[model samples]
Target: MKSRKAFGKLLQKYLEGKCSESERQLVEQWYELIDEAPRQDYTEKEWEALEYKLWRKIESESFETADESIESSKLGFWRTYRTGIAASVALLIGAGVWWYLGNQDTNPATIATQPTQSEIAIQDNTSSKPIKIDLEDGSTVTLSPHSQLQYPNHFAANKREVQLRGEALFEVSKDPEKPFYVITNEVVTKVLGTSFYVRSVDATKKIEVEVITGKVSVYEKEKVNNENPGVVLTPNHKVTFFTVEKHFITGLVEKPLPQIKSISKKPETFEFDDAPIGEVLNKLERVYGIDIELENDKLSTCPLTADITQQPLYTKLDIICATINGKYEVKGTTILISGKGCE
Candidate 1:
């Protein structure tokens, strides 16, 4: 192994994007060594100091050590300053452990959390159609190809938690006391009972959850310590967590259907005769549990006379907009309506 002083210098240069190819290779190898080595502990103060030093080095873009004598004997420099490098090694090992653990396996279903010995791991590597998995609590999961699910054979008394990788459509049974949790690489999706589609795309470094029914709460794993309530999504709403960026973007699904069918009473046939546009939109929003934003207040004067309760949401919007000589656009889960006012 290279002396800690030399390795640190190399790493600093690499972080500053100034290292030679050979130096970069050496730094990578050293990182591998640190990860494989057993962890060493440091006092809080020592760890803080080490982090401060690392940040200082990284931020000093034009740094160049003036110790030419130390560079000459790079391999043996640590022997002469054995005590100095030893102290640094302790911090390096700890930091290495942190980085390795954070990145080990991003597939939350299989790699994020360790389950008790009693839990079961279900995996599907075949490229065929989706696999249907029935949970103990009468819920069902349709797992896509190359996906894996880690769940208890029988949910514990407290909660029903499951981990997932790749894509899956979940149909959770209603249990107010025991919330159903789906842990993906980017976010933890929780719900009392609902159907949703979760997709973790490694290529895009994103995790997406689109709700088909009920409501869901999504929050970052890192934010669990804080009091952040995160975001709650109702039916037809969706959230995308960018793993690389560590942020979320909320939006609507491609086609939203009425979510109250199974839970609420049968909806009245969507029939309207000279109905105010605002009233018509209110009904559609209620049926889909989505937000409808009227961009033009003038649209209120445009009464709609159409029956579209049975049609798809987009189709319904198209017909209504056509009748009023207006247009509707979906922006981030909300429908925006604009048009020329009726005389």
Candidate 2:
């Protein structure tokens, strides 16, 4: 039998392909020793080469003197080389472990997808612990303090859908047609290209859907005995889905304001007759109070509508009053809306 030191040298030689057939067989069992992975999947040939290279390096160390054992070697060059090799080994091991886990046979459903392919995270995260998700799609998702969202490996592949938990929002992409749909535990919101929110996790709760553009469809959950559910919604409007006590809730989403659409409707519908001009200002106060600054007459009869959320409040209000053939005069704690029947 060869001494342990000799055995190591011989194995190294085999890995370098410098060993005879008999010697090669002796280390054949170690052919799969370990591999280095730079990606989700590596070829067998490459794995073999990596293993061989590693073995050759490890076997090259001399056992004659602890001095030559790299670690104890007093020589700076040898010590550095040893440290570098040890670090490389650690890195390779980590990479191998990652690849192996990603290809775990136990998770056949998750295995089909390569790590390179990004995965969408869809979960309802509301009034509970924050969900931690590692996606295949190279995207990382951190749900809000109380919200839920559902995503699939592929959006709209068959049923572009997602499920919401509580009051979570989405930073969705601008897909052309294959719209993204989010279903709350009790509600569903659909979007082709936009950001929005959903809040309908608990049965005794209400869900809200607010769009930042594009379009959205909010539907109430339906309850049927083994049959798929149904939905009714109000397009181009932010809505609140309320709960019903009859086993489940079923109703169309309704909005307090008129509808608005980019492609379908270049115009918005809503008229503020002699309705409290103060109420109109209050609407702005409610919609963008935090973002807008209102003082003096700007607070009285300050009418607004039709995409005024993005522009400056003054510009927005100016347009609003102009649209209604009215004007305003700014005062200390109030704004006077005049020029029309806005008395």
Candidate 3:
């Protein structure tokens, strides 16, 4: 019996297109056997009934296998477990079983040399709508209208890289060794794990990156060869690069808000029940990485009770303000709240 580690290694290599013909066949045989396992004990009569059904279906086929009896048995086995096997295969691939389980000693240079064969592309045509692309590494990109994204079918062992044109939002999966890179015409954004937005508009001939959560590093690709390290951005900060000036300007994103999927904390639900407005704003600042200022200090004493969960940052603000007889405004990405004092 092949050890579990060895079997996982073999499966990984096959998925990476690095296995020899014999190794590929061996993996396929193992997969067949795994798929053929029966879920329930069957009597002879039950087996006969299954065989009869399979044969009835096969009678209409024009092609016949030379090993008729053996092929029929394989067909019967497949019919019993095909759905379960398909789901298991999808789960394994999504979980990066190969990368996680395989020996990690492969030379990075050699892995880089592996030719990329498959590329996947996604696009959005309307500015009013956006689309999301799930990458093999468990990261996701939300492409804005009039945008195009191209990525490889399988990531290189040493890095996860993709190309973007136009605008998009990225929620990257964390992998310390295999850094993620988003390359565009004007700038390249790199990070281990974070969420951010990138917009490269041709009319303006500039590229913009807004850090929504975590940290990101953005550099002009042309300047990197000259040893320019570029700028590192923390949450709520943004960097814009002008093609004409060949320079960058750092600022903040409009309407910065918390990224729900990334944060893992207890009582973290956006739900509020007569929570102190000050406490609510603090949590918002922490989650969204944006600063909030209470123009009227007395607003701090006010309490808000609402289930603003799942609402957009602005919507939640709207609800809170409406309840408190207050108002909020965006001033260069900072939320300033002003309201009548609550007695």
Candidate 4:
């Protein structure tokens, strides 16, 4: 390691874009060393004092006595470099203080928290078909073509985090104590043992998260500490984060599927004879884990006789609405039915 004063001068020259190629590389290496160092909690004043003490210690350890004539020559060199050396020391200290403070002052809720010391493994899918990457924690990631995923070899005790670029489907394992976090450039999706699809390819485009099972929490990375921590989406629901607009839009997925837990327990017989519309809607809600609301309370009393087990959810809704002379519209994750009750 170079002496503090010498390193500071080189760093200052690099900042001003005056360093040669070799000097530039050397400064970058130093920066990487600083970045890889373990973080510590230190106030600005304390950091300054530490920096001073650290440099003094380094100087003392590396110090060497010189002959009187050599010392006189070195003193002459210092006289010429004094001003530049002072500015360099100040610049380096300022940068160190800024980095220490910035790292310590982050939101606890931020999904892109500091990574663990464990080695990270990256999976890049270059093939046309999606590739499945199994994690050590029993979770799996289906990385789409041209996409990449960076995950640790072993999850930390407190949380599981992964970085995604492009599109991927995450089937997280159940660990209530250690929630899973998927971080994209624009948004973060947090979950506890859920299956969800995330698409965040281009920064200029939109980032989307659609839940297949369980629940997911999606939020802007910059607004983690805000009163509104983004959108919480349940099964069949999705949230889209528009990068340019910096906002989220929540809605239902295009082709919503019945929740696995609900369907696996028992087979659903969508055959109903003279069943109340409310009862029918209630069954649909439970099956798909979606919300269905009626505009008129009386609409729920309308009788419906239909065999909808063979039809898709929307088609079944269409038949039910047509039978009662009603219409349905999707508002966010909920389906709304409006009609003047059956006469």
Which candidate's TM-score is highest? 4
**Between candidates 2 and 4, which one is better according to TM-score?**
4
- lDDT score for candidate 2 against the true structure: 0.46
Q: Tens digits of per-residue lDDT for model 3 on 1-343?
A: 2233354566667777888999877556544533332212333244345444444443433254546766777766754455343344434333333332422443333223322222433343455789778898899988888777767778888888777778889999999999998877757788999988899887998999988778888987655444555898988789889989898887667665564443455435678888888888888887777788999777887888888867877888888787668899876557899887565
Clashing pairs in 3: none
lDDT tens per residue, model 1, 1-343: 3343354455556767799998776555433423332223333344455556544543342243545455546634533344343445445534343322323344435323444423544445466789899999999999998776767787878689887878999999999999898877657888999999999878889999999888889888656444675778888889999998898999989888786653447764678999998888887887788888788877876888887877988899888788667788878877898877676
All-Cα superposition RMSD per candidate: 13.4, 17.1, 16.3, 10.6
Query: Least accurate stretch of 10 residues (summed lDDT) in model 3?
Result: 109-118
Q: Which prediction has the highest lDDT against the true structure?
A: 4
- What TM value does model 4 have? 0.66
A best-first ranking of the candidates according to their lDDT comes to 4, 1, 3, 2
Off by over 4 Å in 3: 1-160, 168-173, 211-213, 225-229, 234-238, 245-257, 260-274, 305-307, 322-326
Write one digit per residue (lDDT tens) for candidate 2, span 29-122: 3332333323323343454466467656555532335645346536556545554554454344333432332222323231122222124333
**Span of ten consecutive residues with least summed lDDT in model 4:** 30-39
TM-score of 2: 0.34
Report the alpha-carbon TM-score of model 3 versus the true structure: 0.49
TM-score of each candidate structure, all chains considered together? 0.65, 0.34, 0.49, 0.66
